[model samples]
Target: MTTGPSQQATFAGMPTPLYSGSPSRLLAWLDCPRRYRMQYLDRPRPAARAQRAHTSVGIATHNALRDFWDLPLAQRTPAGVAELVRSSWIDVGFRDPEQSAAWRLRVRDAVTDYLRRSDRERQPVGVERSVSLKTEQIAITGRVDRLDDRDGELVVVDYKTGRQVPTDDDARTSLPLALYAVASARMFRRACHRVELHHVPSGTVAVHEHTDDSLSRKVAEAESIAADLRRADAEFAQVGVESPRFEPRPSAICGWCDFRAHCPEGQRMGPEKSDWAGLEPAGYESAAAGTALP
Candidate 1:
């Protein structure tokens, strides 16, 4: 006798479990099911690669920005920002101390310039705010970098320190941003349709406004993904690593995949990138630090 994913619950006479995870988990499944299984389902999850230079820089920059908001009104200055950057800096994955130090200074200046246009007097409603969304199919949680009350409505702001500058289309198509906006609106009881991608390096701000209809569509999209994930998780529960559903999706992204060492299929796609490769001018493989799975 064979059991299907949805029917597996019937064998134990228990209701199907609702998939509970962050938006990242859902996206991970989409990025590559094999990698997703290794990351989330494998017993004693396979070790990922060492942190790359760009990830370190991205983390430091995000930390500095996060801490900057916590400072006293008077402490919000260029000097204070620089000190935050220095304190938050991670010395890992660099070519050497010289390269690390130089990037540290570059990050400092970029953050300072990014902050200059802000209204320092007005504190944000939430910095690194955790938000969650629940549907009948799934429960998703994630943290928003910044949340602001502009006029009576809330705005979702995500910082980008990567080589790729976000565009209005990026904001419009982003599942996470739309989900964040929906969660914020529900939590604060205010309209939150506007989302912004703030690129710290070039000081470029990409904006998008979501309507109720558009947000509904995004929610539907999430629900669909979750439905697929529920089945995948069920299949994994039965077969473990032998499940045929987890197939490697090889692409250029394989070069930067953290789990490349364990995935021969992905490894064949390209040579593994060096730890410092992401720090180069053309190194756009990784997204923001601590965010991208690959």
Candidate 2:
């Protein structure tokens, strides 16, 4: 039997598939390829550690803020925010019920103060709205905490509950924020160049304005990361867990990594952080907003 064309040759000319992921996924690969593989590619997916107290606080605050916009305009008061926080509270990862209750009240007060600065009567263009961006090389998706229309221009707002008060540099350097801006602009068919990091705990707002060149640079950076991920993912498909591309990058972050239990190298870096440790002053990082994957 004579074959017209070999199967290998038939498929050899096909272009590599575009990588599909959220901004968080691209960052995961950069943070630790092994963790990314385990989190996203592992068929039986390793179980992550329990949520930390800070994450609970962040999620609850985000939830309350999201629901706050849904309330009747007259009910968007301090009392309403207090009630929302109470209802949205996640009572987990705390040392005890007393600690949880205390933090709950703290979050309530902080969120109330944060919203006080906003024009409650003017509804935001989007609240926790999901947005996406696509290029020839990759597809990225993420959710924006808030989207604002100021002077006919769209702005991306990301809420931060961490102790690290964001700065203009933080806003400018954030890959997720930049991606959200690009996605929001393309989705709404409007110009979006401004991004803000709102530190809800302290009610501090950090802003950055991106130029066309800057936004393009960010997209290129994402494409570069996605290209690397695509190769790693393909290698995983061929050899599974034995793929050499998935290597651990141990650092101080390993202490707080959710998959520390599963990564021997990460476990060796230091003692894993206690579930409630994040609520401690020393444990604060910029991760209080939680992961922004779709």
Candidate 3:
């Protein structure tokens, strides 16, 4: 008897699946398979202004904050972090100097607020730690923002620069956080049961508690999604003609898609422009807005 394609095998034997069924990629798969095929599979070079800006700001912000956390407790001063932010800052996507200035101020404020609010009692155990786990045939990989040890237990901390605060439920359901928890626990040889989202804008922390079973379930779900994506790709390859199997799923976010001007369905959806930072307040909104259109 022959075995059908297992979930694990779908992502097996690669240097790490270049694309996992991350929440981001899942939306891409849902929005327009062609876009996913081009970006993920074909690995096309990005040429759009908005895309470059969004990616640049997020990278700059994440890196600056990570560097701050890497500083010694005595040196984790507001001035130091602000300087880091300035050095890492990138102005790729902003249309005007005023808009760019406004974002820089916002980032400065967020970093100041985070430094003041933190306890500074303990240091981060890891910053930007990349981890991977396999289930059946699928391999999932992600870089955690930060991981800290508190009272002998591991904590997964994610930094958010958006305007709104995520709820405890949002943290619990987050795939990256869950994957981080799983990988951290194994890496540290201890249990990691708490996940926190540090909302820099609101200066508040959202916390979620996870059971071992729940973490396992999240990994299983990710592996299952990876399996589905692999199957879809295979089916598309067999039929050819740009995969009719993958159709455009339009939504409120069509207006904000960077690919909107280029996508047929996106163009028909009526184009509307929005700033990357100002447009989406939450992770879900941002992810939805990133989808490719018709």
Candidate 4:
């Protein structure tokens, strides 16, 4: 006897299992169901294009930041950061070698400047830390850029290298950041209610202090997202790409999406951006960091 799309997962007697993945996965599903299907459901996942220049920059910066704390306390200086950036640099998706090289130097300086204001000697509670939280319906996991124990309180820090310099409102309502804080608190047996978005290029930090009520709301929000994902996932399991639930959500950022190539709706929305379109603004570099790209 065959099963229907929703009922195919169980033996009709046992309890359903928890859904587990990084927070990015949940966000991806929420962001666009078609992209999510391509990214996570396809039997042979479609090949995504090579990383764009901005993503390359983000990755290099994140790697350098993650590796910084591994260096000796004496070597965790501006020079050290420069060295890390240079060594971790990814030369990809740039217009040419010259452009790639120029951005490399610019990113190195940005990292150096950002590190100058940081107390490099103080060891972080966790760097590039993997934390997870579970509820009856879902299990969410993600890696944090940095976890700080400031005066015995835990703080979640996420590094952003994109053109968007995070605002305080960005910190206050970030689902991933809130989930990370809650997971860190649970894993470390400490209270963690503060989340921060650290824009590396501009040396700007956006912070939000969460109360118990707010945290509960965020968790509930995640649960709601997960519920939608759960139903869609079940449908995908049975119908594959033919599932009606897996449809595209077109928006301005569709051009930036990794799976946009497979989406006709996305293609009609606008011309695709060049791989290197996000690396600079029209006139000044630093001032335009957060101006153009989404």
Q: Write the per-residue lDDT of candidate 4 for residues 207-263, one digit (tens) a residue.
A: 999999999999998988888887887778777888889879999888888877888
**Candidate 4 regions off by >4 Å?**
1-9, 282-294
Clashing pairs in 2: none
**Highest lDDT against the true fold, candidate:** 1
Q: Give the Å error, residue 292, model 2.
A: 32
RMSD of each: 5.9, 6.5, 8.2, 4.7
Candidate 4, run of 10 with poorest lDDT: 285-294
Q: Give the range where candidate 2 is weakest over 10 consecutive residues by summed lDDT.
A: 1-10
Candidate 3, residues 15-83, lDDT tens digits: the string is 433334455665566667656655555434344435544555567778887788667666666667667
Cα error, residue 259 of model 3, in Å, equals: 2.3
Candidate 2 overall lDDT versus native: 0.84
Candidate 3: where are CA atoms >4 Å away?
A: 1-23, 30-32, 43-49, 52-57, 239-241, 276-294
**Reference-based TM-score, model 4:** 0.92
Query: What lDDT score goes with residue 182 in model 3?
Result: 87
Between candidates 1 and 4, the one scoring higher on TM-score is 4
Steric clashes per prediction: 0, 0, 7, 0
Clashes in candidate 2: how many?
Answer: 0
For model 1, state the Cα shift of residue 64 in Å: 0.5
Question: What would the per-residue lDDT of candidate 2 be over residues 1-294, giving only the tens digit for each residue?
Answer: 111110112255576455678889989988999999889989799998888999999999999999999999888877788889999999989999998987887887777767777888778999999998989887788899999999999999999987678999999999999999999999999999999999887778999999989999999999999878877876787789898999999999999998888999999998988888777362222222222111
Candidate 1, position 201, lDDT? 84
